[model samples]
Target: MTARKRLFFMQLAGLILAFLVLEWLAGVFTARASLPYALSLLAYILPTLPLFGIIPLSLNYTNNNPDLPLSAHRMAPVRRYMVRMGVSMFFYVIILMASIVALDRFELSVQIKALLAVLTALPIGGIIWAVSRLIADPDVDEFERMIMTRSVMASAALTFFFAAIWGFLENFAEAPDFPLYLVVVVYFGLFGLVQPFVRRGFR
Candidate 1:
């Protein structure tokens, strides 16, 4: 594999590992003492940043899309990847701050806070959709887009799966805590984290 592809794989693997480590650490720290409001927000925001890098790379653009100047053309691939990711980070942070404010300046209940973080994807995903289209190869971008779309749909379908199973166990068998937080884990946690590796295999 070329350097870019190798780096892509490394970044992706690192992202998955980071999510597992961070989620575990968050649990341990929250158990001992709750994370500060800002830190808590950061925890939810940080894990998804790696994916900003993945979106442009995953498009697998064989040639530069926008086409930089002749001097910059040689490094066009790296430059394009950086530009795409930079734009994504900008939007991600925007959504993060917006949701933080939307959650009543962090005054909301824990469940609502979690819900805001999970739902931020709705807008952020739109940014991803737009960015991916711009960066994708016209011929093959559709396939990549299809893969991404299916992954999202599958994750969403699993949400219903969890609802049915968890609801039955909770209502019929008397489970505690209601297990609603599992929604985030099932949708974004497992499928969200797992889909990149699956996408990587496509290249």
Candidate 2:
């Protein structure tokens, strides 16, 4: 495998390891009655930031596979997408951390708390903007666009299916309620998971 391919695989492994470690820490923090709010929030929030990196990485690897000869022209859209996502995710992490800290540290009014919540959700708009930009970008290869569309559809389907199952379980069996926000995470995960299968069909 080429260097990019090797780096991609290494990153993938590192991401999974980080996730497991973070999950364990979160569990430990949850079990402790005296854990700091900051630490507990970090345990929950930090795991999500790394996941955004995987999308652009996968896109780059797929378009510029070592075995495939890709031109600079072909690589531009991927590069652009990476930059957009990187910037968006960066702002998301910063804003989320600030919002969490502010909410925890200060005794704020209900209105302020609601405003903070709105501010925290604002960065998610960046994600939506990035995706919409990618779709509207004329520079992206037709093949890449098709792959992205299919992957998104598959991810959406899986997320909806999982949500339905969890909703029913919560209603009937007294299962733990699933956080609605985690649907985004589940969609992203399924996005990555379905890539290989989607590519196989085109191959």
TM-scores of all candidate predictions against the true structure: 0.40, 0.74
Regions of model 2 farther than 4 Å from truth: 1-4, 15-64
TM-score, structure 2 vs. true: 0.74
lDDT of 1 by residue, 1-203 (tens): 66766676787778768766865675566457665667765665665555565555555443333331223444444455456556756676657655854574447888987787776665556545544554353433355557666677767787788788878888889877455544654676655665776678788
Top candidate (TM-score): 2
**What does candidate 2's lDDT look like per residue over 71-131, in tens digits?**
7886776677777887787787767766776676679999998887787777777776787
Error of 1 at 125 (Å): 5.9
**CA lDDT scores, all candidates in order:** 0.61, 0.78
Q: What is candidate 2's CA lDDT for residue 99?
A: 79
> Deviation in angstroms for 117 in model 1?
8.8
